[model samples]
Target: MTSGWVFEEAAIVFVSILAGIIFFYISSPSVKHEKKQQLEEGTSLIINFVLFIWAGKIVLNIHIFVTDPLAVLAYPSDAHAFYMAVLLLLVNIVYKATRKQMYVGTVLSALVPIFLGSAFLYEFIEAVWNDNTMSWSHMGLLFILLILFLIRYEQIRPFTMTALIFTIWSLGQTILTFILPYTTLYGYMMSLWFLILVFTISLIALIYNKRKVT
Candidate 1:
């Protein structure tokens, strides 16, 4: 019918396709063993994905049922949910596919760009569909990348390199935020926090590695 209706329909179809992809990939027999190990590792990536989807749906319903400016914030709810869902899916798929590798460095090298690219794509999608404004929450994608890096730190030197990049990005954002005070500055602050967390994890990994070497 109208352009607006067309866009809405397309968005719905895209989301449906994404959900199907996640379901099929996660349920695949090839990755079934890795999924079991990941689940046992206390990393609730799948659970978080499901929760984000449920939260987005609930927020959308609340927005529709209520009449408030606050409700409109839910307009980006689906964007956030989709971002996380795609991220977790990507990480799970990569880890499962690469788990058989003897060296963790190979896994890190293979996954880092894929993970970062996925984050960029999610932000690009948000810019196109939800709001033209990109927020720091999108940086959560980087945090996911860092988490994966740290989890396999013993086997990956690239984790150190990625941590360095993350640190620089975080510090740069913090500096820019000081120069420009805006709502988006919050995103910079969050990025700084994420970077700090990454650094902390990296430090721990380094210390552990050194101790073992000694």
Candidate 2:
């Protein structure tokens, strides 16, 4: 007989795969008529991100996974898993970009949207599944921003779009932090930090592009 845990495990796997595929598709530079190399690079980027997530999970709970392989599938990843995944992904990207003499700005710009879109969908699913009312408003705004992203995906470069989306998301988060009584300030410090990072990167990219044009 099928059990709840089995379904939960299946759902988790499905969501993870779906997130990867979505990232690959939406972030494909050719989707908006960019070069074929961009599509290939985007695919590699998403694949590396997924692989790192799985690897991080295994590395963090090797004992448990070794004892019960099923536990690895059943256990949900936490913030540490996310942090590890990002760290590994950054390392991979940096190594490849440096070795190949690829454009660092282009690579990073492509990554940010994929990250935000994947996070939005995953968080929305979890919030709905767990009946977390506190997250509903934030997720709702995220959905709208995601829709806007889709509508304009082909029109803008990934970095500019990523900056726009992150800025909007950060604004929404700030509003939620203030208006929602249950919102925790400690929980939102990361969002603020991310906002600053996005703004800084976007500003630098703009300045660099302007200098290159002139």
Candidate with top TM-score is 2
What local distance difference test score does each model get? 0.46, 0.61
lDDT of 1 by residue, 25-74 (tens): 34323356653443333124434455655455455466563766444433
User: lDDT per residue, candidate 2, 31-118, as tens digits?
Assistant: 4544445545655777777677778888899999989977785666554565577689878877887798566556545555555565
Q: Which residues of candidate 2, in runs, are more than 4 Å off?
A: 1-39, 61-74, 101-120, 127-130, 147-155, 174-214
TM-score for each of the candidates: 0.36, 0.60
State in Å the error of residue 37, model 2. Answer: 4.8
Backbone clash count, each prediction separately: 0, 0
Superposed Cα deviation of residue 6, candidate 2 (Å)? 8.0
